[model samples]
Target: MMKGLVSFFFLLAGCHQAAGAVNTKTILLFPEATSTNYVSLKPTEKVLHQITVCLRSYTDLTREHSLFSLATPNKDNAFLIYFSPPNNISISINNEDIFIKVDPDVYYWKKTCVTWDSTNGLLQLWINNKRYPRRVTKTRSPIGPQMSVVLGQEQDSYGGGFDINQSFLGEMCDVNMWDSVLPETSVRVILTDQFSLTGNIYNWNDENFQVHGPILVLKDQYI
Candidate 1:
């Protein structure tokens, strides 16, 4: 009986080694291109008229991969940030995918941000603080509640059906999201690391997310 209990405790600890939240200076390292590794962000339940997501990642993947994925019950690609090597990045809102052609150098410690507003239906993507041409979509629909936000894999279902080919394989950090569209000045400050403006909706911290599988949360300076 004693041996069994000890083994069970060890198993629990190993399964939950990095299961809690992550900090601002922390980076999540998805060591392989498997669909099982991911981070699930938990934010308060609320309808969103606007949203802004920003994060930095270091990777050398040449194929298409998912950087951020948010899904509703009905729409798996409700808010997805997917990238195809060289110059293509796509932002899908309410199942609509829009592409933005950017400079070819999009890997290795890249900073990315995307914003959308329902009031004006304006969408923008920023790479290293460089804003691209704005577009519009889903002009009047505010995103409903019940969101399943996942990092490292694209969801083909509400919270399941992950594809290995679309899984993010790299080190990701500074993942944050806001309920409002951030201004240019605020974005510039974030890109420059002038201030640590955490997102009201979701931000990288020690209490906002859950890690799964064999992922590592390491301090940023080491990498």
Candidate 2:
């Protein structure tokens, strides 16, 4: 019994240590109306096998815009989150695009969250904590590194494609991303603006990105 207890304690300690190694960072972006306003990020993890984003969009125009994107240096491989007016939201993984319709209200702020897991190719989207149906794709491989991550403009090529027609013109806050799947409880925390659990790959409190153009900052409650 004594030996078993000692082994159990050791296992617990190991688990704690492993959890401590994850990166937790987040950021906020208030995109300008032009294509020049954007933010860029790169993760040390070569393959973004899984990812999640929690944010609110404040654009009221019925135009196409990009919320988030990640692509290789050569632009050959990529994943993207795009929004089109009249309640359309799309996700692109390795060039395969999947879309879902959302609420059409553009004036009111909306709590939005998206998650993608490459392991099983499960993709999920949540609005105001209410989850939509899940979609699956890109199960064969993971997103490679040396990626150009951007917020606001869609990457037509790898990292340098911007079209004014597809630029984001809105306030985005409480932006968070994780390299793994988040639990139900964590999702709730994010939606309520009481987030204590930090993202393993990107914590908003920590600076992990660069801002370009005229992105602004606003209160977290605006979302």
Candidate 3:
């Protein structure tokens, strides 16, 4: 019995150490909006990670009725991206979140990118590779601190009541994360997807972020 106990303690220590080594990396997901790719990530430290994406050309069906979001099955935290056809962009968080939408009429091509920085608590809007000055919304919760990341489709009803049948149809590429929020200027540069060392980046096109499996989540109330 004594020998067995000693072995058990050693095994437990090893398990703890391994779990501690789970560093937060960029989670890149390109689910068909109908499929969900899930991952559980608890940051070793609090940092701002940039979710890079290149939305595919908008379609009438999806543009009129669809949303892109990051959420967990717990329903405690959520960030929503919704834009109907014509001209309207809005973002709302049930809890700690940030996102942007482009007004098709305002911008002819409707090409733009936005950055959500958890560390600095800022939302950046970029148009035609130019950084536009805009007010940032502070998170009610500090980016959930630690969250189980879910991408592509909604996780049951936890995703702000998003229906799995309504998924985003687009390509998300060159996702990255840094231990700190990026400066406004840096966000403009990286929007081109040619920058090096944005800390950690998951290039969906590169296959670093894959689709398969159920994501993990903490029971904590995030937002």
How high is the CA lDDT of each candidate model? 0.86, 0.71, 0.43
Candidate 3 all-Cα RMSD: 13.6
Per-model C-alpha RMSD: 11.9, 6.2, 13.6
lDDT of 2 by residue, 1-223 (tens): 9999999999888757544432222325554567567788765556787778776666776778888877776543267878877878888877778898877655766778888888888988888777878998855477776677787788877777677888887666545678877877888777765434556666655666788876765433422
Q: Write one digit per residue (lDDT tens) for candidate 3, span 1-223.
A: 9999999999888766644432222223233444444432232234224333222222334343333454544444444445555655454444543444444533222334555654454665564565555536665343433344434444445433445454544433233344444565666555443332333433322333334544322222111
Candidate 3: Cα lDDT at 120: 51
**Candidate number that wins on TM-score, 1 or 3:** 1
Ranking 1 against 2 by TM-score, winner:
1
lDDT of 1 at 189: 73
lDDT of 3 at 97: 38
Backbone clashes under 3 angstroms, per model:
1, 9, 0
Global lDDT for candidate 2?
Answer: 0.71
